[model samples]
Target: MSRYSLIRSMFRPARTTPHRCRRDIIMPFPVGRMELIVYAAVVTGLIFAAYHTTLMDYLAYQRDYIAFTTAWPSKPADFKFDMNVFLEHKRNLMEYANLEKSLMQNGTALHELKVAKLYKPLFTDIPKILLDKWVPDIERFEGVEEFLNATNFNGTIAEEFFYLEAPFFQFEHHRMAIMFPTEIKGLLMTIKIGDCYFWSTCHHTELELRDGDMHVLDVLETEDGQWNISRVYYVPAHELLKVRF
Candidate 1:
């Protein structure tokens, strides 16, 4: 009870209390099992969708790769490669086998003297001028209207034009934007060499001219010397080169 004793006791350190563990108190939200499951499923679905979309894109590109390597050994897949309509058609020609047969056998050439001639008006002035000057077959453009109407283009030049013009992709697989515009330059167009139309990517595909105008060993024969129609016989502009023993 002395003043000195009281001061010494006050100066002494107080006894340390034991540390208590705080329980992890989760906020008492009344979440049912179904709610938790639904939330988890949504998250999982989002992840799956993202992954699936990427996988699909990759698969589509690979499909193009296989087609390129198998069909066009001559044309390498670079930034500057374009496919002709024949090659494009060949991608799914089997589905349209009957139609192709009719087109090839019954309907004359997709581009005849008459079809190319009469169809000149639909074009802009520049194209009209170019077609008028370059396209020798005046009457050939005449029949395209009937042909397209009979076919799927509904009398529009959409289908027939796609056939004649050098290909730049027709929204198959995905979109035209998928391919760089520059990459389209190296496109081997379908050359109207003779009675047959040929897809020609010889610049990149390394197609060698054999005889007069035949590149793939000159298998096709036509009086006009222009390969006009893409037949099953015509080699794809891009294919694997033969290795000599």
Candidate 2:
């Protein structure tokens, strides 16, 4: 009530309680057991799925590795790089065994010479200028009359000059005919190559001898300076006759 008593009461310290002085304790947020189990199961399922997928990919890679490692080193037995005439004769000697034998024994040298002389005309020439030059005296050749009479062929050199691979014993070199057939009746004029002559003895299924199908030949030079036909490819008349001159 008094002014002095009121000032003293305001300045005096107040009594403190034990509950107010105590510190507050912190606790974790509550979660259900089912929710915890579901989260654990989802994480385990993801790990299991990843493991199986990785294992499958690894097994596929192993199979490819084995296949690459176990394969054969070289080409198969039936794989042929070239079709050699001599090799074909040796494989199946039906009728021209004797004729082919002569060339295999003695005609190696002559083959080289003929190939060297006719390389430009036979292999590389488009106009065949060198061929006309080389065979300028074709009319005066020894067997020209007999050949012309036998075949009845009356065409110029540019029309019928084509290299062929005959399957029979016609007069020619290396047991293969270098025949010039000018007539449409397939009259083959067997040229004289040394003592051998190309003659049609027998016709096989493989011998696709058309009127103008050209035989493209490749010559191979051996290690011992020997030259021979290395590869033979047949181009049909439709393709060959398309080339002008």
Candidate 3:
């Protein structure tokens, strides 16, 4: 070739190659049917595993919800109040009272009454100081034992004086209403009791019981899968208007 022609060829753009047809291309290792099947199975397994994990989490949340809502007795009928448990509770109270009498007679230190054994086991786990309110009394107890003892004493006194009073202390008439899962951190409940009286040579007189006092119970699930009340907030009947169920 001439020197001038070679220089012109170098300066000009090279001719572009024609595009190859799609059928002309070939993979180094073509995918076999078995390989495709394996790939599909792996993808399906991953999807199922993810779905199963999500489903398990949802089921767990539902279980926790159910446990929390049904933790307390809904009504008097729902409460498994065994007469044996009640009799044992009453006996404990009577013993504690007798012990108190003995302590007074012996001139012992009454400030610290060690009657922890008398407390009902069912309520001993409740905190001594609950939601800024002290259980049994405003005065602080020496320890958990003393606090529980005092709590049992006060509880028994309240039951005898208010609940199991003269003429009409029917267990059937006692009812409890609960409003659960409020926007706030606790549940609200009310206890209703019936009152009636008999008159001499006249018809029976029925007295309407006052509106029940509502209580807000702060419940917590323990590590061992048991539910417990951490605190109780007393909401007066009139204040129920402020609460959202």
TM-score of each: 0.24, 0.22, 0.23
User: In terms of lDDT, which candidate is strongest?
Assistant: 1
Tens digit of lDDT per residue, candidate 2, span 1-245?
A: 89999999998998767563233333232236886688778889999999999999999988976764454233212222233643343344333334433553586654443334333422332233222121111211233333334333323221233222221223345443433333422222232122322222221112222221223232222333322222122222222233313
Q: What is the RMSD of candidate 3?
A: 19.9
Give candidate 3 misplaced runs (Cα > 4 Å): 12-48, 75-245
Pairs with steric clashes in candidate 2:
169-199, 170-197, 170-198, 170-199, 171-197, 171-198, 171-199, 172-197, 172-198
- What would the per-residue lDDT of candidate 3 be over residues 71-182, giving only the tens digit for each residue? 5445322222355555565566445445544654574332222222112232222222211221121111123233224334223322332211222121234532222222
How accurate locally, in lDDT, is each candidate?
A: 0.36, 0.35, 0.34
Runs off by more than 4 Å, candidate 2: 1-30, 72-78, 83-245
Question: How many clashing pairs in candidate 3?
Answer: 0
Q: Which ten residues in a row have the lowest lDDT in candidate 1?
A: 236-245
Model 3 error, position 194 (Å): 27
- Please report how far candidate 1 places residue 140 from its true position, in Å: 30
